[model samples]
Target: MKQRSEQSQGTVYGFLAYLLWGAFPLYFAALKPATAFEVLCHRILWTLVVCLIALAATKQLRFLRDLARDPRRLGTMAVAGVLIAINWVVYIFAVVTGHTVEAALGYFLNPLVTVALGVIVLREKLRPLQWVAVGVGVIACVYLAIDYGRPPLISITLALTFAAYGLMKKRIGGSANALQSLAAESAVLAPVAVVILAVITARGETTFTTQGVGHTLLLLSTGIATAVPLLLFAAAASRVPLVTIGLLQFITPVLQLLCGVLVLGEHMNLARWIGFAIVWVALAILTVDSLQATTRARRLARAAQGAAC
Candidate 1:
């Protein structure tokens, strides 16, 4: 019963995380006159501030000391920080520049990119169905390229950078909790963020100061916007099964896609629709394969327990 309750809580946490993430395009779109770069810098610095406060409140500052002593983990987190920074800037650019649909497509493609990264970087082998799903994903990309008259660079970059960031987090493993990890990443990028803000201010191009109180508050609120969903996701991950997490991940991209098409009024031609359809087919294939694999693993565990008894 406790486990079931935990799982239910996790589902709620996961849903809220994805819901907030899905609504990000609207938030970012509202931050007009602030260039993506300016927004990213503010995001990094403010997120660091928020993380520090959370760490202090939770009495988890000791993790920072531990992280400092571990050079390898620190270095890995630094790289992860860079990767996430890239992802953030690109995503913000997509949202602010009327490329929300492309942003949605990128997230939709992220799981497949993660699978390919596992095979290439982690030396993991894909199951037959997984391979087929990946193949279909490739075809979808090709179709999208043909339809767009060029590769979907925004989508591809978002997918690749985010997948690489995930790999870095995987390497970090359980060495750090989500709050600690985010704090460290933000710290690593804080110096650069400071410099960027300074440059923007010097050039008189910063929207933070010129944009009125409400806009200034909106920019400041980016910190909470970035941190809350991540914390919720961490909470969900701790409580839920991997399969549940996997299934719930789709909520984010699906919401983004809906926001882009229905809310943002992004134009989606027939070709683009067909391309998205193909990607969905690949995702469906992958989902089924993951579910079956989880079931088999559970069955094997049960059979082993029965044999031992």
Candidate 2:
């Protein structure tokens, strides 16, 4: 009963995280901001503000002090900060430009790339099934590339940049919290946003309208919408295991796929369906291998304890 309850709680957290992220496109579209760049600026600027609020509420100021003292960790965070910002910009661009279909593809391809990067960068060994999973996923992407007659740059960029951000975060030691890190990163970029706003206003390139209060308020709320899900995700991450989180990541892509087809009215072609099927099969294989691997690790640890006595 206790086990079931724990699992249920984890499920709830995972679901909340996925649901928020999955529904993000609708919120972004509702904002109807000037351009993706403007939306990106608000996302960064407001995300920073949200982070600072969380940091204050949590009293993680001590962590901030330590971060200020440690240059190495701070430097790594700088790289992570930039990559995540780039990811934010690209994602907003996808939503704003009505190419959410491409953004969906990017997220769908993210997990496979992260797994492949683990093998290449961390020198992790993949099980047979995992290797096959990786192979199938790669083949699917290759098919897309060939069929499209060009590389899937948006998908690849989002995947690789996010994966790199993950890696950089992993390497940073100590209490450099995600929310705090994001806030700091956004703070770093805030000046550029201010300057751009100034330049655009000077050249009459700014999109804000004094005549419509509703539209202006909607644009401003993009920050809250962008920041809230992330805060929820951070809260959920502590309560959930990595595998659960990994599985939940699929929800965003699945929703995007639905949104692309139904809302955006993207056509479904045979090649696209076949490619998606191959990717799904690969992910299934990987998920099974991961479950087995986790079980094996637990058993081995118990056996080692028994031997120790």
Candidate 3:
């Protein structure tokens, strides 16, 4: 009963996290005239400020000292920071340039990329169904490329960078909590952010001061927007099974796709629809395989307990 309650709470947290993430296109769209690079710099610096404040409030500032002592882990996080910064700037560019649908496609493709990375980098073997899912994903990408008359570079880049970032986080293991991890990544990027902001300010091209109070506040709120969903995701991860988390990951892309078509008025031709459908089919197959494997593991564990008893 306690486990079920925790799972329920986790599901709620997961939904809220994805909900916020899915609505990111709208928030980013509202930050117009700021330029993606400027927005990224503000996001990085403000996120560091927010994380530092949260760490201090929670009495978790010591993690930073411990993390600094571990050069290897700090280096891994630095790489992760660069990867995430790429992902963030690309995403902002996609939104500002009205390619949010393509951005949505990238997130939809992320799971497949992660799985492929596992096989290539971790030397893990894929089950037959998993292989089929990945193969179908490749087909979808090919179709998309043919339809677009070129590769979907935005989608591919987002998937690759985010998947690589996840791999780096996995390498870091559980040595740092979510807040600490985000704080460290923010710290790593903060110097570059400072430089960017300095250059922009020196040129008098910055939108932060001239953009009106509402816009300024929106820019300031970027930090909270970045951190809240991540914190919720961390909470959910602690309480829910990995399979549940995996399934819930679809919510963000699905919502982004909706926002693109309905709110952003992005055009989608029949070919694009067909391509997205193929990707969805692949995701469905992957989801089913994951569910079946999880069930089998649980059954085996139960049977072993019964035998021992």
Alpha-carbon deviation at 115 in model 1, angstroms: 0.5
Task: Please say which candidate is ahead in lDDT: 1 or 3.
Answer: 3
Which residue ranges in model 1 land beyond 4 Å of their true spot?
none
**Model 1 Cα lDDT, one tens digit per residue, 1-309:** 999999999999998998999899989999998999999999999999999999999999998888889898899999999999999999999998999999999999999999999999999999999999999999999999999999999999999999999999999999889999999999999999999999999998999978799999999999999999999999999999999989988888888888889998999999999999999999999999999999999999999999999
Q: After best superposition, candidate 1 residue 201: deviation in angstroms?
A: 0.7
Error of 1 at 20 (Å): 0.7
Q: Give Cα distance to truth, residue 253, candidate 3, Å.
A: 0.5
- Candidate number with the higher lDDT (2 or 3): 3
Rank order (by lDDT, best first): 3, 1, 2
TM-scores across all candidates?
A: 0.99, 0.90, 0.99
TM-score of 1: 0.99
For residues 132-248, write the lDDT of model 3, one tens digit per residue. Answer: 999999999999999999999999999999999999999988888899999999999999999999999999999999989999999999999999999999999999999989999
**Which residue pairs in candidate 2 have backbone atoms (N, alpha carbon, C) closer than 3 angstroms, thus clashing?**
none
Q: Over the stretch 142-168, how does candidate 2's per-residue lDDT look in tens digits?
A: 988886678778888888988888888
The positional error of residue 59 in candidate 2, measured at the CA in angstroms, is 2.8
Instruction: Show the lowest summed lDDT stretch of 10 residues, model 3.
Output: 171-180
